[model samples]
Target chain A: MKTLYIILAVFFLILSAIFSYLPLGTIALIPISFAFLFSYLVFKKSETPNNKFSKILLILTIVCLIFVLVKVFFIKNELEIDTKFEQQKIENNKDAKKDLEDLENDLE
Target chain B: MKKTLLILVLFFLVTSFKSDTENPVKSGESLVYSGSYNMSGLLTQIAQVNMTTEKVTTAKNNYLHFSCSLATYSKWDSFFKIRDVYESYVNPISLKPSLYKRNINEGGFIKKEKYVIKGSKVNSTVSFKNNQETQNSFTIGTNTVDVITFLYQMRTVNFANFKVGQTKSFTIVFDEKEMDISLKYMGKETINAGNLGKKECYKVSIAAKTAALKGKDKNIIWLTADEHKIPALIQFSIPVGVGNLTLKSATGI
Candidate 1:
């Protein structure tokens, strides 16, 4: 049962890492992180046969949780740049029109 | 312990799949931006045409107004013959829900012989002659030739199925003859239009085997890089040189 718990915790941790890039994935990391922490706590209390493995899985889970949080925050800048690029495009159009009109009169 | 672990694994898997559904923009929503185009070409028998157009629009509708002058430098005359400028305004109203009342106004100079025909001084009048509607077609025109051509072109676009990367191929039959045409999806690109900042646009290219104004070799148009898919740029090769038309500028108000 302890081994099963360790395996499950590792599985959730991997899933969390895969989804860390997506917005909704950040929320998902919470439950998986808790499961890893809880399993570690439970396994630590008992004299489990795979105690070393449980410790490794617990460490991995913590690393994934931290990685996910960092990724979610890092994404903000990229989204902001995309927004600004769109705004610049609109402004450029307005200026081009004005210049063209002026050029039209100059040619005449 | 096993049950708790299994539950946790299942929870994470389900949550990962859910992230794919979130999108920032919704369908049927409109976004507006400004666009500019520069084109240089020759107008058969006439002087070289270097035109620039600017445009503004929401995702669904667009207004393009352009003014251009022709510059002629002939070997025989030596002196440049620059004509009085002409301007045109085009508002491509998006018929998203359905066709609505729209207006098209065009006034320009056409040089004939040695006289520069001024559009304002000439007997040029803007009038609405026909307003007819069928099940899938609508026609409004003060000019019969222009209106008929507009209506025929409108029927070719399958608005119901138009989407990104979708290609529409058809033949336009005018005066009982078929003109093979193919409009291909050129995807999206970001272009910086001089003073205009930058624009994200879905580029579409239209090619025809033969066009009314010129033969098949010179008929190509780049449509508006927005959701409306209006023709923002048009270029055609003529017998003498080439003619290019662009959306210079627009005023929504």
Candidate 2:
């Protein structure tokens, strides 16, 4: 039924929008494709065959697809060096070295 | 019950007399991995893991330092940042750990733990986010090792002699607790290791004696069947979904 297709389209559209904004990267494309499929089905089953809801769903699907594609290609997953963590590492190493010396003396 | 007791005794006896295997990993060896999580059948990288080894010399002794660090990528840092480092200082030839340190900062929670292993006893110090500290000492099995050392020790194991379905067990001190973990050999398989091409690797499934690691035979690791024996792939079951680590680069083998 056209109503069922519209409902599925809306559901998938929401999921695609949410996933696109999250750090899940290109995974949003899955929901976007499903939204597009359901939106096409809704349009085909509609009596007028030019329903505004179907058009809106299709547009949203394209927006989400484009957003995810831009994120996948442009966003680089790089690690930012933490200076505080580096300092903590140095301190831990220093303390460990001293402890090792004391331990060796105790063993001897 | 009597059979179980006898089997346990025999297992202990066998493990006690086993000598150290030849060292396959050397100092300055570094391996970088991309830790990803499976979401909707798509793998999304979450963290960058780096495992490195270094030779450290003190006034009295020389030790091998095995350091493993995990840090979330820039994008994930905003949502749930994790900067964790686990290190083990061990004897170069025997791989017997002397000191183990873990400093983890996940989200906003922070904790630090250190253990000094001497003979058959371990001295532990744990500090929490509130600056509360606890120190304890306990006795352990002679062959008990820390997590980082246990990971490096796996490379020294001779998998060629192991039969399929054979399990090798180890007692590892993690989070100030002694855990019995076993690795079941699942035979050799060639997997496509990124940047290293196709490598023949020994597939082994890991089982832990704790509820933290759920599912049977779901956690598996693949190690390169070579002198270096670097870990090529690791797959484990997580609460949300399955997580895996793929070897991105290896150097100084």
Give the top-scoring candidate (lDDT). 2
Model 2 residue B41 CA deviation (Å) reads 2.9
Tens-place lDDT digits, model 1, residues B145-198: 222223223333533345665766644333223455566565666644222335
Q: What does candidate 2's lDDT look like per residue over A1-108, in tens digits?
A: 778888999999999999898888766778888999998898788788667877888888999999988988898889997998889888988898988898899899
Name every residue pair that clashes in candidate 2: none
- The digit string of per-residue lDDT tens for model 2 on B77-143 reads 9889999999999999999999999999999899999898898889999998989899999988999
Give candidate 1 regions above 4 Å deviation: A1-108, B1-166, B170-180, B192-197, B211-218
TM-score of chain A of 1: 0.52
DockQ-derived CAPRI band for the predicted complex in model 2: medium
Task: Output the TM-score of candidate 2.
Answer: 0.89
- List each candidate's DockQ score: 0.01, 0.62
